[model samples]
Target: MGERVLIALGGNAMTAADGSASPDDQRRAVEGAMRHVTALITAGHQVTLTHGNGPQVGNLLLKNQIAADVVPPVPLDWCGAQTQATIGALVLNALEGRAAVVVTRTLVDPGDPAFQDPVKPIGRYFTEEQAGHFEKLGQTWRRFDRGWRRVVASPEPLEILDAPAVEALVAAGFTVVAAGGGGVPVARDDAGRLVGVEAVIDKDLAAAMLARAVNATVLVIATDVPQAVVGFGTADARPIGSITAAELRVLQAAGHFAGGSMGPKVEAVLRFVEQGGDRAVITSLEDIGAAVNGAAGTVVHR
Candidate 1:
């Protein structure tokens, strides 16, 4: 029998490891990723896709900075919405026009504590001196292993506003793509109006929420790695296979995952499984089909 599957793609799905960002490169990447998706579809699973937009949005922000004098820079929410359209288009086209793309919106709390502590990194990297200058100008910047970059608030996604549209499309037998870049983070105003907010929400977390909203039986988080590892850097490092959600949570609390990378993915999977999802899998995009069947990747279940 077919299952409703929600696949959350990591940023690498839209770009190459070679750092190629040209239009052709992006299309080619999406085409490559969609091959796996099509395989699942052919096998009878109803699949919906969501992807990260870090690199694409960062490039847009860089362009805004370089062309600031001639043109007014676009806001963060706008940049996110743009990527949703752009990447969603690529995914739809790659599926040979068989899918629907929803320019979705996610509701967040304006009072989310993440706003007070900006920690989600975005845009181009800067040197220590450059970061210092930006800090003095009241911008939040953080240094990563790569370099210093501007950090923005990443709020929790309370609701996927367009989830009904997604469900409708799926019920009509359409492969749906929604919630790119966490659905353009929005919050309600005093008058109960939905307004875009200058914030980013974690794509994996949003994917889990969407999966639950649509009553999806499986959530697949596709990343660059074939599977998540414990003791990731050392000799004892080993890939995690099928495990109960309770066991995974213990490892997460033991600090096996890094906050920036695998941590969010693990958290997202745990949330889905603990909150009524039958199971969730974390795997590389290339092995998504096998992962879905419990033949590959790190499978987590209740």
Candidate 2:
């Protein structure tokens, strides 16, 4: 039987690690992902897609810096909106005009703690001296295994404004792509109008919000791993299959997942299932079909 599935494509889905992240490269990557998506559609399922634009948005920030003297840099929210359209175009191209993309805006709390303390790492890595250079310009930097890098706020997604449009598209049997880069983080002013913020929202968290808003039964978080694993990169690393939400939370609290990556995926899935979702699966794009059937990936249930 067909089902409604909301798919969250990880950052790696749009760009290859080895290949140059050119427009051509992105189109090729999207085409391959679309093949997997089309497979689900052909089997009579309704699909909606959301993607992370970390790398692409970072590239835009870099370009803005390079041409700042000649052109005013774009705001973070605007950069996010621009990437949504650009990535959407690439996805639409891959879909061969069969899908529709909605440029969405997400609401966040104006007093969200994330804004008070930005912790989302972004852009390319930098050496200590380079970090110092950025620090002089009032940019926040943090040390990592590679080097220092800029960090920004990853606010919680309160609502996805265009979610109805996405759901309507899926209802009409068309695949819809929305919530690119967390839907250009925004908040309501005292006057109750939408105002763009200068920060990036976590894509996984935003995906969960979209899933909830659209009332999707299954939330599929597609990434580079076929299944969520514990002791990742260690000799005793183990794959997680089906697990209850409570068990997953215990595992997460034990420090089993890294904050920047897998941690958010686990958090997203937990939020979905806890909030009445039937199930949420985390797996690689190639294993999507199997994941939906409970034959692959790590499934989190109520």
The reply for model 1, stretches above 4 Å from the true place, is 127-139, 142-148
Q: Whole-model lDDT for model 1 versus the true structure?
A: 0.91
**CA error at residue 267 for candidate 2, angstroms:** 0.9
Model 2's TM-score against the true structure:
0.93
Residue-level lDDT of model 1, residues 1-302, one tens digit each, is 98899999888889987867789889999999999999999999999999999889989988876676578778789999999999998998999846999999999999999999988888888898877865675568888998899899999899999999999998999999999988889999999998888899999999999999988999999999999999999999999999999999999999999998999999999999999999999999898999888889999998
Best by TM-score: 1
Candidate 1 lDDT trough over 10 residues, lowest sum: 130-139
RMSD in Å for all candidates: 1.9, 2.0
TM-score of every model versus the real structure? 0.94, 0.93
Instruction: Score each candidate by Cα lDDT.
Output: 0.91, 0.88
Candidate 2 error regions (>4 Å): 17-19, 126-148
lDDT of each residue in 1-302, candidate 2, tens digit only: 88888999987789875645788788888889889988988887788999999878889988876676588767789989999999999888887746899999998998999988988888888798877866676667899999988887878888988888888887777788999988988898999988998778888999999998887889999999899998899999999999999999999999999988899999999999999999999999999988877778999998
